[model samples]
Target: MRTILITGPGGSGRTTVAAATALRAAGEGTPTLVVGADRTDTLGAALGAATGPEPTRITPNLTAWRPDAAARFREDLTAFQTRAANVLDLLGASRLDAEELTPLPGAEELSLLRAVRDAALSERHELLVVDLPPTPRALDLLALPEELRRYLRRLLPPERQAARALRPVLGRLAGVPMPADWLYETAARWDVELAAVEAVLGDRRTAVRLVAEPGPAGADAVRTARLGLALRGLPTETLIANRVLPEAVPLHGLLAQQRKALAEWTDALPVSPVAHLGHDPRGADDLAALAVPGVNTGHPPVEWPVVDRTAEDGVLVWHVPLPGAIRDDLDLVRRGDEVVITVGGFRRIVALPSALRRCTVAGAALRDGELRLRFAPDPQLWPR
Candidate 1:
């Protein structure tokens, strides 16, 4: 299945675009699912139909879903508390009532990811259109699975789980209590779910579709989003310039600004301009008229591999595609066999390939939206 993640700066009409895209696919006789997260029926309003937590048929072949984050959060937390009941009882703590359980800051993101994972794995839809949050939040939300999985492994290594049978024996010898079996079981379950999400995200059939109004602010947002997405190696399917005014529009000022923005994006990514509909689309007919193109077949997953330059310059270069990375916000450090990279507010520790593990970071530079890190093999560790 192909999944198109749609997002942009807030109020960029991403929801409308997502709705139109899914409708278009459905018209072409493809099974399509449009997923969004809103406290209310924003997606339903766009589709001119009622949508809820469950899949609702919007048209002949398209289904719409607006997952209820608050409800899901409540259910998840309740189950987790039940699983750790013994631990809570030992601490003399009472369980949280469903009414008192408010959704946390990151709950919506997790819920959204879970919805996407479930939809993708179900194989019911040939196309999955997700209307995501604005650029900054969306990028962070998309990166959650990998980052969380990393933390889970570091905190509860799977190898440690193998010593489960010996945990009680070791605990008695050390005069301390080991983590209960439930803890490891919970960790293992979480790991499996997170891995599934990550697998869907890393699939070649998935691509991000950016929807932003044509203007200076939108341009800046796209640039920042591009940088962040590039660092994670997320492939962009299209840069949809939404709400573009017509050339004959009397306002010369806005027209010039939009044209400039369009030109800049055209030079950077795949540009698809969706004209201003003059009013919010009312239903499937209106959405179809908008003609938001059906999803592309999609490209292969983005992978950053170190290119060997030993014969040419005796150095190995790691080419990391960071489309909008600014030099000022970029930082890199080689820590043992992993490189810690901080681009803007996002940071990731990526393990170096075996060949680069014995090398020293000689230099780095950002050019043409790619970060090139030069490495020199350590003499002591280099193969003679």
Candidate 2:
């Protein structure tokens, strides 16, 4: 399915933009699903209806949903308790009832992954519109799947599952009860689901649409969002300049500020201006008035291609593009087979390419928003 991930700074009308875009696609006879995980029910307001944990029909071709994170948390915990009942009983641990359970802080954000994976994989919708949290939070949420999967690998180590029969013997030898088989099974299931969600995010057909009111603060937010996403290799296709003033509105105050921001944005990326309707957006009429663009052919997924420079520079260069990155805020550390890239408040651990893995980090620099790392052949590891 083709998907559009919409996000912006708080109060930037990203939810409205997402609703309008999905409505536009549905109006044109495409099957569309718009989902959100925001606690405020913003997507429902934009859709002129209430949404819930279940997908609700907004129109013949459009469906809307706001995943119930608390409910999901309760269900998951209850199921886990059931699976590990013997383990709990053996340890004399008390099982908490579902009624008294409350979701943890990040439950809401992580719930979005399950929602997206289910909707995208079902083949029931042709276009999916995701109303993500404000850009900063959304970027972190986007990174959650990969990060969680990494943790899962470290904790559960799927390879250890092969010795399942030996678990009992090992536990006997250690004179302590080993974790139940259900634990590894649950981790494996979660890993599969998280992988699916990560695939949806990294798919070539998925495009990120950045929404922001054109102003100084919005400009800064947009730049930060762009840099953060680029650092993670998620491509941003367009900037939806939301709540724009009319061109004829004297062009002297807010309009002038907006115009200036738009000019800057236009130079750096494609801009789609959504005129303000002079009120908070609500219902179908308001959404239509926004005139948000429908989904477009998305760009190819970002790649970290290695450039050969062994002849001239005696090293190979690995290029990682991170637009809008500042030199002062960037840091890199090579950790075994992987490199940890820290830019500002964001960080990503990237595995090295096979050829680069055998070489040592000769030098590294951030130039023109691209991070270039030079690798010199290591006599010990590289083929002689």
Candidate 3:
């Protein structure tokens, strides 16, 4: 399935674009699901459909939903609290209520991401179009898989030969209930769910379409979003310049100046396969016009960095290119099953592909600004 995420700074017409894209895809005989990630329920209204958390059919093969993040947050908190209560009870503690399990800060975004993953995996849709929040929040959602995986991996224990050595000693000291086994099992379950999300997000067919207005700030936001996505192996496919003034407008002083500035900014954008649409992008017809080939906004072709994997002499070599980043400014962090790279004042958290998580880091080197990390297969940690 192909997944397209449409996002940009607020007021950039992302919701309209997303709805239009969904309509076009459905017109082409593809089952499309458009999800509104924005807190405002404007996407459905733009499409002239009833707004609700449940999927509303807009076309023969098109459906849209404005998921209630607050409601989902409450439900997720309840479920988590119930599980925590059970686990706490097993350890001879009092049960805790859902009120105590309210999400701290990032929990709401995580829940939204879970909803997106579910839409992607649903057999009812062939294409998933996500109308994400503004650029910053959208980037956070994309980076979540790596962040959660890292935390889970660190909290859980290795279960093979290492467990043989550690469990016996811990079991003897604890006397009755062993917490390591439970922790490992919980971690394993999380691992499965995270892997499913990573698979859907990291697929090449899953592309991010950056929507931006013809202005300096909008251009910068798009650039940052593109760079962040690329660092995480999720590349931006199309740069959509929304709300551009038409050429027919009388060319004079201020009006001409604004048009020239827009033209220059559009040309300067980095990612290629660009397209331009009007400010008043209204219905499916307007969107269909924008999706037409050869809109040509003049951006460079996007080349995604590859993660090269090789197993040699019992060590797995992972060569990650950290171009234009200095070693002194780089921060490498391993949180559970995720690796975070901070370089050149920019940070990107990456979800380790399933194959790499089975290995332990043998050594790491940051030479000439390229961070290369080596890992060795850890048989003890490999799931049987």
lDDT of candidate model 3 versus the reference: 0.69
lDDT per model, in order?
0.89, 0.90, 0.69
Off by more than 4 A, model 2 = 172-175
Model 2: ten consecutive residues of lowest lDDT: 291-300
Please give the ranking of all candidate structures by lDDT, highest first, separated by commas. 2, 1, 3
How much does candidate 2 score in TM-score?
0.96
RMSD of each: 1.4, 1.6, 7.0
Angstrom error at residue 260, model 1: 0.5
- Sum up the clashes in candidate 1: 0
Q: Per-candidate TM vs. native?
A: 0.97, 0.96, 0.72
- Per-residue lDDT for 132-244 in model 1, tens only? 98888898898899889889998888889889889989999999889888887989999999999988888999989899999999999998888788777788888989988
lDDT of 2: 0.90
- Candidate 3 has its poorest 10 consecutive residues by lDDT at 292-301
RMSD of 2: 1.6
Per-residue lDDT for 1-384 in model 2, tens only? 998999999999899999999999999999999998787778888888998888899999999998989999999999989998988898899999999999998898878889999888978889999999988889999999999999999998988989989988999999987766789999999999999999999999988999999999999999899889987788898999998888888768888898899999998888999988989989998888887876776788888999989889989999998888888999999999999999978999988999999899999888987899999988898665
Candidate that would win on TM-score: 1
